[model samples]
Target chain A: MTADVRDVWTYLADTPLLGLTATLIAWDAASWIWRRARMTPLLNPVLLAIVMIVIFLSATGIDYRRYFAGAQFIHFLLGPATVALAIPLYRQIHALRRSALAVTIALAFGSVTAAASAVGIAWALGASRSTILSLAPKSATTPIAMGIAKEIGGLPSLTAVLVLLTGIVGATMGPWLLAKLKVADPRAQGLALGVASHGIGTARALQSGEVAGAFSGLAMGLNGLATAILVPLLVRWLLN
Target chain B: MLSYITVLLGCQLAGETIVRLLGIPIPGPVVGMVVLFLLLAIRGGVPEGLDKVGRALLLNLSLLFVPAGVGVMVYLQRIAKEWLPISAALVIGTLITIAVTGLAMSALVKGRRQ
Candidate 1:
């Protein structure tokens, strides 16, 4: 029985469908549970999904790289999904125009602060150079953040992980922080979420409404651009 | 859906070319996003097809990060050693950013009115 079970496991692992199926199932289960929990920030679906999948892979003795081969289909969608950000951003044009100057200035300021603070605090706390570099680009979406991390002498994989963690944590904690700060405007809250957390945060922002979603989308793009341009130079200057 | 996907891919392809030729540090899709944004601004409205696809993608955005997020396991050792700094930076850093950006946006926009 044990021998047969091992053989079956090996056979399943060799196929390409496991990663895709596992990801979908994990996300579904996570989402269902999170919703059942009343969408509590503590059990964010993304975070829950990640934890579930991580354990499944370890228990199954499946290599992550192998899992990625099947899962890359979902990952491939990130490209088009990223391009899609412009839609909501464009939807908010009128709102954007009213506070364009404020938004732009705040984008620059927040982008700088996001990167600088992550790097500064980590480094001061005794993280290695590579670790500091990885932390620097945590606010942007994974692809852009990973690109910036690679350009700035960081571990791109590490940056990818940090970016997700940042997004999950930001999305989870952001609303509470905003409420505490008396940020009454949904649009402003969305901007804060996007500038600070990227896609996952934007996902959370969208739950509030279109205006919030739009601002979050706009903030995501502008923050990505600002970090892409500024972090390389900033990392170079700071590390040297 | 196919045609709309093409528009996005076309922009991304063009953006990739520009980035390669110009040595720009930003990601190609982002530059493509800017191009798409400018084009939409000129058009004065989003095409229904693209909007449909894009919104669908946005609605399920977090679903796509699962694969990459799992890669965290690969660094278990490093993360374990540096857990303190990593956790502190991510948690504290994110809270600070949220507050600063939110307050700044609210104050600046309101200040403009007064």
Candidate 2:
């Protein structure tokens, strides 16, 4: 019976369908719970889904690579989804223009602070150089963050995890912090979430309203651009 | 839906091509986003189908990151070893960024009004 079960597990694991199916099931289950819980920030669907999938993989003895083989289908949508961000961003064109200077200045300050503070705090706390580099791009979206990490002599995989954690942290803690700060403007709220948290934060911002979501998407894209250009230069100066 | 997907994929393809040719540091999808944004600006509005597809994609954006998030397992040992700096940087750094950006954007935009 044990041998038969092992054979079945191995056979099923090889198909891409299982990985894809597992990912969708996990996300749906997590989303359902998140809604049931009244959409608390602590119960972020992405975080919950990731935790569930991680546990499932570990218990089943499946490796990341094999799981990714199936999950890659969903992952592939990230590209198109990113492009889709342009629609919302474009819709907010008038608002974007009205606050162009504010957006530019705030984005500059926010982007610089994100990298500098992370790198500074990590280094001060005795993290190694590579780890510091990985932390520098944590605010960018995952793919760009991972790329920046690779270029700056950090562990790309470590950076990927760190990036995800940053998104989760931002999405979870961001609302409370904004509320505490009395940031009531949707544009400001969205920009903050996008700049600090990237896509996941934008996902949270969208739940608030379209105006917030559009700005969040805009901020996410702009920050990705800023961080990609800024971090490599910052790393050179800081590390050297 | 299919056409909208095609446009998105095409834009991404063009973005990848541009990045490859120019050897720029930006991600392909990001460039694609820019391209699509430009296209929409020229077109003067989002098509109904495009909006539907884009919203659908964005609606499930969080789900897309699950695969990459699970990659965290590969670095559990390293994370355990370096938990201090990692946790501090992510949590504190993220919160600080959010606070600064939110405050600055709000104040600046409000200041512009006056």
Candidate 2 per-residue lDDT over residues B3-111, each given as its tens digit = 9999999999998899889987666887888899989888888999999999998877778878877887887887888889989999999999999999999999899
In model 2, where do residues sit more than 4 Å from their true spots?
A: A1-3, A150-157, A175-187, A199-214
Please state what fraction of the native interface contacts candidate 1 reproduces: 0.75
Best candidate, lDDT: 2
Tell me the lDDT of candidate 1: 0.85
Tens digit of per-residue lDDT, candidate 2, span A2-84 = 99998988899999998999999999999999999988767877779988999999998999999999999988887888778
* iRMSD, model 1, in Å: 2.0
DockQ of each: 0.68, 0.67
TM-score of 1: 0.90
Clashing pairs in 2: none
Tens digits of per-residue lDDT for model 1, B1-114: 889989988878877788889987777777777788888989999999998888788789878877877877888899999999999999999989988999988888788889
Q: For model 1, how does the per-residue alpha-carbon lDDT over A1-240 read when each residue is reduced to its tens digit?
A: 999999988888978799999999999999999889977666777778888998999998899999998999998887777777777767766567877898887777789889988998999999988889889999987777876777777887688778878887898889998999899888689899999999778878989888788889889877887888888888878878
